[model samples]
Target: MEQLLTVKKGNSRTTKIDVEGVYYRDLNAQLRELSSKGIQNVQLLNVYGQRYIGTNLSQPMEIEISGTPGNDLGFLMNGSKITVYGNAQDGCGNTMDDGNIVIHGHAGDILGMSARGGKIFVRDDVGYRAGIHMKEYQDKKPIIVIGGTTQDFVGEYMGGGILIILGLNLSEEKTYRAKFVGTGMHGGVIYLRGKVEQYQLGKEVGIAELEEKDYRVLHDNVNEFASYFNLEPNKILEHQFIKLFPRWLRPYGRLYTY
Candidate 1:
């Protein structure tokens, strides 16, 4: 793999890399080197489907990706901010510990699978099984806010964290179309802006009215998401929202005998 790393020093604490056709390994190696050199910010141009672009990066740096990134874009990333100008592929933030990933466009399936901490904001719709198995610890909780609607199984087997579906593009009268939502969900909460029918949800999931705390969470996250995608937060929040949570601590606890 040819290492095409062009480090052009900007005004202060910024480095720009023209990663047109650089291999993933070489690109990551150069990125690590740049981070070690105290480069606080990095801008990658023409970043097309480079898997693991910001994997396991523990630095508190800011990385801006111009084009679409491949799967596992920020896997296990500890502390950093990644802003993607274009859409992203599957598993964007797989098992991320702590950080922020802001996607200006749509994302693929399993958006935040098992992410222990951090936040993922998707401007448009996503594929199936988003927020699958996402969990949280004592103080660390992951959050994912989808600006548009999604496909089936939005929060399958989620253990913890918060998932919000804004449904900004859907009409007011249209019910949420996703099926088998929150299937086997044990923990966490999913908020949907539009109405959902009882048949569309899993047996273990139950609907609830949005509380004051729910509004606060939605306000904070939606505001942040709107700022990233240049949308009006107030208009987005004007619609009514509903919450989905697991009815039983162990949905399948009866299947096995100890």
Candidate 2:
């Protein structure tokens, strides 16, 4: 039997919850209740492995987490703002439709598995397949800006949207180590800072030279990432970056067509 979390009113519009041992189901239920009551600001402290923290939210609300959150931290979240003070597990933004998620620490594999809207900013490295299958929704393009490099398959099977990776923690050599990047990508773009060898890319991927428009996009998104982590956009944008695109619109269209 799980007990309901005792919601402490931080102020007239803010609520605080200490989710140390509470079940994820009860925690979310309380959150739904809070949202129903028009509570817009929530602070979760001592959180540990609480899955789906803001998945049910479909409106604009602000949530702050203190400890590590479990998988699918903001699954299908819409128009919510989640700020994690610590790390996050796999499927952080799986199928998320809208809103913002800011992580101060590292994230696990498949960071934004199938997100379609809003922005996610991380201050540290990420695991494999950070932006796998990320697409856009209407005029809203899902944006993922990683402060540090990710493992293999950073943008695997990405269909649409923007994926920005800044290798801020590479060794002095300044060479990327991830391989098979954009393995099954069909659409969208990948902006990676640092050097990646030709052999490191997948057969379906191609490198293209950046244009004036590309620089403007980088300038704006880098500033967004910098604002989150208190970094200087100029210092990061000064590094050499590469643009990776899919070689074909349908890399494997023939596989299932006939």
Which has the greatest TM-score?
A: 1
Task: Give the runs in model 2 whose Cα sits over 4 Å from its true position.
Answer: 1-12, 254-257
Span of 10 residues, lowest total lDDT, candidate 2: 1-10
What TM-score, to 2 decimals, does candidate 2 have? 0.93
Query: lDDT for every model?
Result: 0.89, 0.88
Q: What is the lDDT of residue 25 in candidate 2?
A: 95
Candidate 2: tens digits of C-alpha lDDT, residues 1-258? 232344546654667788899899988888888888787888888899989999886456899999998999999999899999999899998898889999999999998888998889999999999899999756878889998888998899999899999989986776678888988998889998877888888888999877899899889999988998899999999988889999999898778843
Off by over 4 Å in 1: 1-12, 172-175
lDDT of 1 by residue, 146-205 (tens): 998888999999999999999887885775789999999999999998788999998999
* Cα displacement (Å) at residue 73, model 2: 0.6
Error of model 2, residue 152, in angstroms: 0.9
